[model samples]
Target: MALLTPEDLEDLLNKLRQSNETIKASTGKGITEICEEVYGTRPASQKVAIVPITAGNGIIGNFSSSLLAITEYFGLEGYITDHPDITGYHQAVSDGADILLMADDHMFIAHNLKNGKIAANHICTGVIYSEIASRFIHAGSKDVMVIGLGRVGYAGAEHLVKKGFNVYAYDPNTEFMEKAIEELGVNAYDSADHKKFSMVFEATPNANTISEGMITDRCLISTPGIPCALPAELAENGDIDLVMEPLVIGAAAMLYSVF
Candidate 1:
């Protein structure tokens, strides 16, 4: 995907804010009240402690700021801490945060916390596959290739399957490929066969994961991966439609789930 212009980002934020407002109006409650009704007794307070952990090198601050904007738009307090270690999570919990939030490479922190390695109630906000699936649905594509079977890619494939799309998944890791095939019932394909797809979901975190020759002419590439899976020259000049955005789309999804 292409980088969203400032105007596009602003418009998206406004739309999300409006959606939240509509939910509040229909439910006759605020975020905390809605959370209590749906998710049992979460902390009623509206504060999130953000612990940044390797949220992409230069774009960390930008990602954090976008998350803060989402929180503030929902009338929640966002406390962002600088430290990206165990200490930061502890500090966030100590700072009266209702939920500890992490993004990007720090996503593993949530799994660690769940496994009892970290003593904190946390949420990792980046399940962007649903967003990609929504885009694909809008584009009227029912068959697509998922180019990675990592956490995010697998989640995306699952979402596509739920939406009644034909999902063909690929990964160099056989174990991941097997899980996708067995659990999600996705078709397994070799990476060398990527060119066969007219619609592709590229979710590997490596640059140039989707090479020029691997992309079909007029393919629709939906990529939420970091460092970009498609090359810049191909995305700019080739016969393909590339969709991309900041990682905040996943953050918004997480926030909605929390509330």
Candidate 2:
């Protein structure tokens, strides 16, 4: 499948609103309604600060634009900062910012902050695996392969298993793989065995973890990991359908947790 355009995302959100009665009831509103409430009608005056932490320079490039777009769509005030360290987080808090949002490397930062190691009211807006699993189920995928057994990948595999999918998982870390097998009862497989699955979810941060050779004909790949796991050639040639859901969805979920 081709990457989801903004219009496609709107359509998907609409479909989700109509079909997911539980979400509608729990949220008590649709995406737009919640956006207005959480972000406020005048977001410019609200002033939410965003910090992007990663090794690369262009880490905030597109993500900054996406956050700006979200603010614009909901009429909220938000901006991305060039600084991505603990100092920057303190500055944002001292400046009376409503939310100090961190992207990427947030898990590490949040962990440290929660243990009285950092002085910032910050949360990571990067937990998307559960939503990714829901997306796979919505797309009619029943058998799934999960690559990487980190926190996000393990959570995604657990959701799929609970939904009664035939889940196979892999990870370079033996401990993570063993825990998934013993606790979740997921089928353990070598990374090379990915071809056996029609639907694959990759959560590894490494680039090109799933190479051209590993992709079977007509496989569907859903990856949320930065530096994307699959090769460009396979995704470009249409041998496999690749879906990288917008990071804004994860950010929205994180925001929902706050309210």
Candidate 3:
């Protein structure tokens, strides 16, 4: 059976909003830190990992997995790393991995950057993230509020701010909020500041974040287009939409047509 429907999507979104309290009660480490601790223990110049990863965690893991597949398609070898395992470190290093392909979780890539050990590549969930951010900024959304602050959230916020969004992020973890303000110069508000921007990009993996009531009616909510932690309801509703598959095929076809 389909995991999500329109009503289910709304319910899931509500649940996500509620989960914020729990997230707030926990340790506030940014996604970059989480990723660093996960796969940055080993240091090599030309290593890779390929293991079980999917879009289940939303765009971060899904995109990372996709990136791993793409790199491998180009003839690169990677260590197969999985979350919820303490031994991924040993396995990756043993496989001679210089660059570990893991989930695009927070602080995982950022930590690698700070350590100056390895380069982290992010798999984008949708081209729309950059597109929406760009559009909103061009329309003068200076005090932009980015929700989620997870892998995709952080990436979107960073890109948006770089383009002069004056990004303000909303996440349950204090760690994420701090990173937004300190590292990215985003305001990091805790609540929904709907009136501030004419456009809003929903980067949360959970499809439930943009139910009828959660999102402002006036703000433009660009769907992930790419698969992520999408609620089954949203997936089934067909309203949220999917873009990655079509975009990929379209790009390939266009290239072939041009060639």
RMSD of each: 8.2, 8.8, 13.4
Whole-model Cα lDDT of every candidate shown, in order: 0.57, 0.55, 0.42
Best by TM-score: 1
Candidate 2 C-alpha lDDT tens digits along 1-259? 1222344344433334343343333223444444445334323344556666664332544554565555444455777775766766777777766655664433422112222222111222222343343343224456678887876688778767876877888898999989999999998876555446656778866778776555456666766676667777666764455555445444554443443
Residue-by-residue lDDT tens digits, candidate 3, 48-105: 5543323344333234344454344334454347542336655665655544444322
lDDT of 1 by residue, 1-259 (tens): 2232344455456554543443343334433444444334332345777776653432343545566776676567787786765677788767766656664433422222222222211121113433343343224456778888776687778767876878887899999988889999999866566446666777776788877655556666766676677887787764565555444445544554554
Q: Is candidate 2 or candidate 3 better by TM-score?
A: 2
Estimate candidate 2's alpha-carbon lDDT, on a 0 to 1 scale.
0.55
TM-score of each: 0.60, 0.57, 0.41
Top model number, lDDT: 1
For model 1, the stretches where C-alpha displacement exceeds 4 angstroms are 1-45, 51-66, 73-75, 81-96, 103-126, 137-140, 190-195, 212-216
Candidate 2 residues lying further than 4 Å off, grouped into runs, are 1-47, 51-70, 73-75, 79-98, 103-130, 133-141, 190-195, 211-216, 245-249
Candidate 2 worst ten-residue window by lDDT: 117-126
Using TM-score as the measure, name the better of candidate 1 and candidate 2: 1
Whole-model alpha-carbon lDDT for candidate 3: 0.42
Where does candidate 3 stray beyond 4 Å? 1-128, 136-140, 190-196, 211-216, 223-259
